[model samples]
Target: MYSDYHVHTNYSDDSTYLMEDVIKDAIKMKMDEICFTDHVDYGIKKDWDEGPIEYLYGQPQVNVDYPKYFKEIESLRKKYPKITIRQGMEFGVQVHTIPRYQKLYEQYDFDFIILSIHQVNDQEFWTQDYQKEKSQQEYIEGYYQEMLNVVKKYKNYSVLGHLDLMTRYDEIGNYPFEKVKSIITEILKTVIQDGKGIEINTSSHRYGLKDSTPSRDILKLYKELGGKIITIGSDSHKPEHLGAYIDEAKELLKEIGFDSFCTFEKMKPIFHQL
Candidate 1:
């Protein structure tokens, strides 16, 4: 079984799964470990006064309630001793949000952190509103350019989450990888130099994507660039999705010349043989 490092619970505005239920389900599925990496995007655009809203169009602007989040996880830790439960956060880092994230790092003791780029200039790429403004090449370049900036500025994260996440929401279908290869290479180089890594987000398969985020070609490039640190995650938000396709992700890593995958404790990488 694989350790699912990217997961969400009720603490995240988007998810409804209670933390305890997530733990119970992970145990039932025979997972070795699980981490709660709920959403923490600082500048998410939403009408907070409004009650419930749709995600594809209007994103909920919310942050994790750190005290309650950690408190519940600690209780779950003692309650479920057999499985390792790690405390983590998926930080949606924009160039402007770096200072806020720095404060968050200092305020909490997280076992892991997955730095992700969900939006740029406070505009979410998932929505058609943002996508309509730019051409395919323009949007793709803009996404990677923002990511490169974030990677260059932030060093406290364990790995980059869904490195090519824009592809999942691209209405125009696949963008030519060659167009962004040079910039992607630069981003990977920065991450490796900072001793950071990337995750193989298995949710791509669930989303009917043809390849994993940061596809096999990008994974191969990372390996060739001497970037060895890699982790696998389901990016699961519900009980049914827990540990989904994790074994297949590991096998994919092995085929790409990665003999092992990584886990984290106190933000330090630990390799596990595949």
Candidate 2:
């Protein structure tokens, strides 16, 4: 079945695509399943109720309004019964933020959750705050090290979102993959051993990147390590971005020796043929 497992709506601070509008677009795209993985970066943003609304990059920054978000999801599920809609969130978890995530995990019954490292020590990558004052090796290694540390402590997620995400914000250029290969291997092994997976985020195409978000090398290494749980997503935040490049992502996975991709329900993986 065709599916886009990572999506964003207005519930996310960085997006303004309305929830119902996104669902309608997914249905028009003939998507069989769609999961709303909105952004919730604990270290960089605040919850809707925690305090006054703040602004980031010209957008009002606020985490998902849980009470209203779930209410709307239920309403939409009934309003549009054709597509299989799932509730999910993208938690931007840092090593120090594990406790907050664990507590949030116990409070919700999400169908899926994407573990992401949007920042480290409250410093964001897009702004280059985390990468400044460090050599390429230092920043890259630090990013992977944080991932390793977080996965070692957090188990409430279904898959790691955009495994090599820091590269997207690196203004210099793609660093040598071999330099961070061992650490990435360790991260993947930990994720696989913990019964977790990684997502092939299609946003790389939108960004005009030379490879997939995690890069082909990482995908190959994951296969070599016998790590099989995989999902594909547009990581869309706009109407034009919705369900973009999904077919190409599937083909790339097939070329990499992966025969199936996954969708999630109640935090469990359900595989589908490529």
Candidate 3:
């Protein structure tokens, strides 16, 4: 089945594409299913008194309006009967934000949730400010350390989104995978042990990277470690980007010795043959 699990819509503060437009585009592409994994990041600003700020790619990053979001999803589900639309969220996890996210999960019924580390100690990695004071090694290592901490503390997610996401914004260019392999192994092992999975984020090509997020080496390592739960996503924020490079991502996983990827229903994994 053709599916793109990681997608953003106008509900996410960073995206401008409307939800209906994204669904229509996926339908036109002949996708069997698509999930709206909109962003819901906490700790963007220290004080609630401060107004919205441009924290993500120069866009004002705000938390997802859950009530309105789910209501619209229900509307689209009936509006588009031919394709399956799943309710999902890309939760930017941090140690301090775990409690808030836990409450969110308890309140809503999500088909899937992608645990991601977008900020370390409230400092966004996409901006150079976070990297300014640390050496390249320190920055990369710190990112993984935060990821390890989150996986250890939180077990409410379906998969870890873009396991090596820091690479996309690393100003020093590629840090040797060997430099962080040990911690990454621990992170992956922890996720797998917790019944969680990882996603092959196809946005790497769109961002001018030569490989997908987490890279081929990481994917191979996960397979070697008996990590079977995998999902492929375009990480699309626009209509034109929907389902982009998903076939290539699936092929890459197959090359890495994975026979199938995954889909989710009510937070449980459903395997699909490649």
RMSD of each: 2.4, 0.8, 2.0
Per-candidate TM-scores read 0.94, 0.98, 0.95
* Candidate scoring better on lDDT of 1 and 3: 3
Question: Which residue pairs come into collision in candidate 1?
Answer: none
State the lDDT of candidate 1 residue by residue for 1-274, as single tens digits: 4689899988787788889999989888888989899998877633233455446434456677778889999999998999999999999999998998998899999889999999888887766556786899888899899999999998999999999999889988988888899999999999999999999999998899998777999999999999988888898888878899998998898888999889999999999999
247, model 1: CA deviation in Å? 0.6
In model 3, which regions exceed 4 Å deviation?
A: 45-58
Worst 10 residues of 1 by lDDT: 45-54
- For model 2, name the residue pairs that clash: none
Runs in model 1 with CA error above 4 Å?
45-59
Which ten contiguous residues of candidate 2 have the minimum total lDDT?
54-63
Q: For model 2, how does the per-residue alpha-carbon lDDT over 1-274 read when each residue is reduced to its tens digit?
A: 9899999999988888999999999899899999999888887788899999988678786789988898999999999999999999999999888888899889989999999999988998988989999998888889999999999989999999999998789888989999889899999999999999999999999898888988999999999999999999999999999999999999999999999999999999999999
lDDT of 3 at 75: 100
